[model samples]
Target: MDAATAWLVAAVSLLAAVVGPFAAGHALLTKREPQVATAWIAVCLIFPAGGALLYYLFGINRVYTRARKLVAEERLPPSLAPHPTSSSHGIGPEYAEQIRISDAVTGRPLEPGNRIQVLSNGEEAYPVMLEAIEGARETVMLSTYIFETNTSGRQFIDALSAAHRRGVDVRVLIDGVGEYYTWPRPSTLLRRAGVPVARFLPPRLIPPQLSINLRNHRKILVVDGQRAFTGGMNLGDSHLLQSQRSHRVADVHFLFDGPLAQQMEAVFAEDWAFTTGDERTPPKRATPHDSGALCRTITDGPNEDLDRLVMTLIGALSAAREEIWLVTPYFLPMRPLITSLEAAALRGVEVKILLPERNNLPFVHWATRHILGELLHWGVHLYYQPPPFAHTKLFVVDRRYAQVGSANMDPRSLRLNFELNAEIYNRPIAEQLALDCELIRARSRQLSSAELGERHPAERLRDALCWLASPYL
Candidate 1:
């Protein structure tokens, strides 16, 4: 071979050798499922450098998104929201209310008459949560994916420790995957302090056998078996909001004091059961009374079709009569939901999606942009909230139905991971969620097709790549 050709060949060969395995390693680190890892293997073996770049920019990122199998026993029907067989999409108040009660004692609803309060962020959520812990009259249950051992996490631990000290039943559950890194793990700290702490699905070390994507993404806290709190918020030190995230985050949490709160209490019980092999403290049997809210507790795990959360949201979108407003930090909905949002706008449902201008996951940013123009064209209003990456997952429909939880709009939150969301049929909760969404919209910049089209070449290329990774983002 000529000298120049030989050098070129050698350099490219060297590049492929180094890049290919590195890409595979990156995928392994991100918890890419075995199938995706295998796909990466094919891509790397075939295209070499290009495959490695594609996988790095996308594929092997966040293994938690892989199609991890949920313990089959946990998955409920996709229609947990109630059968929409009737021409009317709205669930009957009686039916929805019954779902809340039955979720705990039985898989049915009870009359709800509890108060619901929206807590803005950790600054607001933590204190109230601690107070609840302090005042725990009976059992105290807490579950979360990320439980930091930082300033805020310590306070909750102390409160729970105190509750434990007070001889109240206190059970704390933390995702084994999310809190895997600690001196002995934060749960250990709680356990040593005489509080019972359980880890959910601790990672088992298996080399080259990738795929443990089924993660518990729900963040739920219940005290006294009567009051509960849930939302996208995790117990971490990233207290308030910041416009620019130099590694920052923001979230929303809600407190409930009705029969609806009992549902969250039950979700915690189920997880505590799944992990610790123990059941929740039996409820103080009282004649179930109404707390005055129409609600349902719907959960989705593996062993069922993927994207149950998004599918549930699609149900709302399909039934949307007036306006559909959604906010999620990472917005990679599966095809059906993507189509549903577009169709909703096309069919005259006023649809709006609020996302972060720059989320922690930029590849997700690209994925969301790919269809932004399509949505905008279909009369869907796309708005980008200025940063700190508000991690609130909320949906509002016609001032009637609302959903809030830790699940993002992406497939990972829907299909691959365990997610908890409360479906509220009351007008007040719906109105409140809608108003908050509007407040967030005020801080956001609306995007149009013209601006997206005007983006620089490099920026556009990145977005296209992001869209390609949308399925797993």
Candidate 2:
């Protein structure tokens, strides 16, 4: 070999030797999942120069780092409001530990006197939400993952614009990534309509902000600091199954009237402040009476608030005595969660999980199939609700404790996305949610070990591959 070519080869080998191990070591030290770490480590070692660049660009936990910076600068507001009137009465001693778990994780008090109404779909949720916007006397703070520019989304845009024109304190926050679901994005339409709107962490070229993993997946609509709406539903026509012929989704949303609404307002305020750098002054809310239910909101994301909802879920699952009913669109449970489910079922608790028979994301559903045998072996019953794909996310324990909101059972919702969930300590509400699940369960088909085992080898291989990539999904 010539002298110049030999020098080039030596330089390349030296660069690989230095960069590859560094990236692999970083993944080993920082990644939470062993499989994820191993995958990155293998990539770094196998491809050396290119793999290290990939790890530097995509493998690092830049989301958490950026979030930590926001917190350090006091840009991200605290999850809970101040001077909360926590209700300790009427709740049984059985839920004391559960209460403690949430309290410790969120530091948010249980807001009493919350009157929650279940809205079946956009048909029910949208009208009430629009009515609340129309009737807003003070403020209308709305945030959603997707704000499509379809027929249903336009109604919301018009309502928010009308509310703004009427001198109401109106603010709309749409997820940066989800805004691209349609052309003539809602932000643009809202801007043209004289409504104040902001996109959460939108992709930008000037500032070079392009990361899309840590998205704002929260769905919140707080009106007048007295009424709020939140759930798995988004502001889009797909949720209007009554009118749509295909790609329709079935979901549930809840309207909160009482102190819980104020708490939700606080959550929106924090998210808005973080997104737009505008500190919103929350309106003084009247002291609400102890209505029918007690609830607390749990806000989680890829920041310091990470793992809070998952911890709350594990705590609730561990505390389940009689029954546990969980429903979600996605079904990729982490190892600890799967272990908790197994333990719950072994303790004589009836553990039932409901998932969609058809999924909007087929890869997620395929990945979910890979873990069915493990859960089934532990006496956990799993069911698939028939299509029009179910988009509801719910968790109920013993018909006394329940949770509902935008966070799904997958890693994207629990670990990466900014999700909002509420823990309800009302027997009636829990029973109602459980009953809803029961009705769906009746129409659903339960999965058996034999069914999973009978899958073709190639199909199982595909599912296994998808499962291995669940962290990214």
Best by lDDT: 2
Candidate no. 2 TM-score: 0.92
- Please estimate how well model 2 matches the true structure, expressed as its whole-model Cα lDDT: 0.87
Mind giving the per-residue lDDT tens digits that candidate 2 earns over 16-55?
A: 9999999999899889888899999999999989999878
Query: Where is model 1 more than 4 Å wrong at Cα?
Result: 1-111, 181-184, 206-211, 242-246, 281-291, 305-307
Local error of candidate 2 at 278, Å?
1.3
- Which candidate has the highest TM-score of all? 2
Local distance difference test values of all predictions, in order? 0.72, 0.87
Query: In candidate 1, what are the lDDT values of residues 315-403, reduced to their tens digit?
Result: 66777767999988887776678799888888888898999898777678877787787778878898988867677788888777788
Clashes of 1: 17
Backbone clashes, each candidate: 17, 1
